[model samples]
Target: MKKLLLGSMLVLGATSFGAVVEDLQNNGAKPAVLNIRVKGTVVDPTKYSLIVKPLDATNTTDTMQFNFDGLTIGEEQIVEGGYSAGVYQNNILITDDYKIETSLKRNGQNATTSEYDQMAAAKLAYSLGEPQAVGREYRGKVNVKATGKAKGSFVDNGVNLEVLVKNI
Candidate 1:
């Protein structure tokens, strides 16, 4: 009975050590900061407004497959005009400023001016983390919703959209 107990202890110890080793070997390096960028356009700004949100947004059931780093991440499908949304992951880090910048252009002109108040309302609806080191790396998500209405006819590329993730 004593010999059996000792053998059991040795087997358990070996199994635990093996697991630790396997984890260490399989643990690839994660990015210290992930820069996510979403770029798309709204076809007819006058007829429809652009709505951008996370795939896992509350009460959100529509989702499209998005490929990120070879992994399939859920994407929120844009139901408006010819607008398609996607998330792009960048391993680079933004050290200077930490903020969401939105740019809208119609016919190669800035659409965020007071002349385009409705378009200027475009903003970051949800942001996960701040630009600060709280003793650990920051990991979260951001959602940008650019809403606007242009006074013009339907052009194939009526509005241009650009959303950049500086820090988090």
Candidate 2:
């Protein structure tokens, strides 16, 4: 009787341990939510046009890119330096010489901007453009593009620009 009781206790303990391990594994599989803010100034509004769209628009089967699934862009807000009558419409910000900013949120928080360069470098990429086989629809990353009036026109990415506007 004593040996039988010991064996039962061991089985119960192992089952409890397995349950804890499973819980941890499931929790780790959950996705994270991320919020990305992009802000920049247009040095020459007349010379450049900006477009914002989903990252999947740039995807190709030939090239691997970051999985930007679950990203959505908010409205672009003109911070300063624009004409008094400037406006944003059709996912395009129409304004003259302005500082602009936009926000992108992902998954509830699955991806982040910091992970962009790393994932791109690692080649562990996926596209959220099409619906997944699992019947999940994801809102993916925002693609912000700036094009100049002339062909091959140059525009700065604004990684090192100073504070041009404030108070708004």
Candidate 3:
């Protein structure tokens, strides 16, 4: 069992240390800050994992198959694919100066406790980087209510599982 779990960790959460840009389709539902968070010396929440759960106008749930690294928009017109899974890119991080640390957390406990290890949800904290932006669009937000259905691609597609996934 230990070997199996360790192997799984190797496959899923094995990033050295870097940036991770995630793309969630507009008018779609994707969970931010997935199971694993990256550690660094600048910002801890600079990157996050995604889980897309697209929905319809009437609040009906719809799923779509996405390829964050390999799939391109106009590759084909898609309606919904429940069994389909979204794509991901790892260690696609940004540059900063603040000291950052990565760990696991749940509820309100520390990130390394046994309970946090078994918890399903994790939260990441972001700190100020050197030469902070006085006023700019440092943060980005998307609406996942099934509206902006256009082209999609992941950021830094050259990396593993990297995709610029977004609707036009």
Candidate 4:
């Protein structure tokens, strides 16, 4: 069982820290930060499942996926896919930050968990880089509801999950 638990931790850890944010402080640009808060019901509160998609003004075909398959539910989750610097800087981030659509599932069947809040969500703190007048924008937004034609992607059996996005 130790191996199984260890493996789970490794996977979760990788999702939280994939690549370091780029350093653009010399260019007079400030690093961008995103604060994601989630609430409502889910399949397994103890399990974490998420997806991050980069957004750009003109381009809409870039996305990155991560698996946080251990953290519990109803808490604030902090995900830093990479880093950003300027707007239309040619090499700026695809989008200002990212949009997350989430759900819960298990054994290919819908599951349920107790209420989750912003405090329980994992925290993804943004590192400083450079300062800029404008940054990327939040694109492709999704709001999980109790009943309104479940939107976004689903996990093992997650069908009633909720999600919220914030740019800080």
Best by TM-score: 1
Among all candidates shown, the one with the greatest lDDT: 4
- In the range 1-168, model 1's lDDT, one tens digit per residue, is 999899767656654332212222356653344334566643543332223333342212232211111111222222221222322224223244344445555677655431222332221121122222322222223333333232221112244444454454
In model 1, the runs with Cα more than 4 Å from the true position are 1-97, 113-156
Q: Name the runs in model 4 displaced over 4 angstroms.
A: 1-61, 83-168
Question: For residues 44-113, could you state the per-residue lDDT of candidate 4 as single tens digits?
Answer: 4343323233343322223333333334444334332321222222333344454433333334443333
Alpha carbon lDDT at 154, candidate 3: 28
Query: Could you tell which candidate, 2 or 3, scores higher by lDDT?
Result: 2
Local distance difference test values of all predictions, in order = 0.33, 0.29, 0.28, 0.34
Instruction: Please give each candidate's TM-score.
Output: 0.21, 0.17, 0.15, 0.20
Between candidates 1 and 4, the lDDT winner: 4
Model 2: ten consecutive residues of lowest lDDT? 77-86
Backbone clashes (count) for model 1: 0
lDDT tens digits by residue: candidate 2, 108-167: 443323122222112111112211111111122222322122222122222211111211
State residue 63's C-alpha deviation in candidate 2, in Å: 15
In model 1, the worst 10-residue window by lDDT is 64-73
Clashes of each: 0, 7, 26, 23
In Å, residue 101's CA in model 4 sits off its true spot by 22
Task: Supply candidate 2's per-residue lDDT for 82.
Answer: 10
Segments in model 3 whose C-alpha atoms lie over 4 Å from true places? 15-168
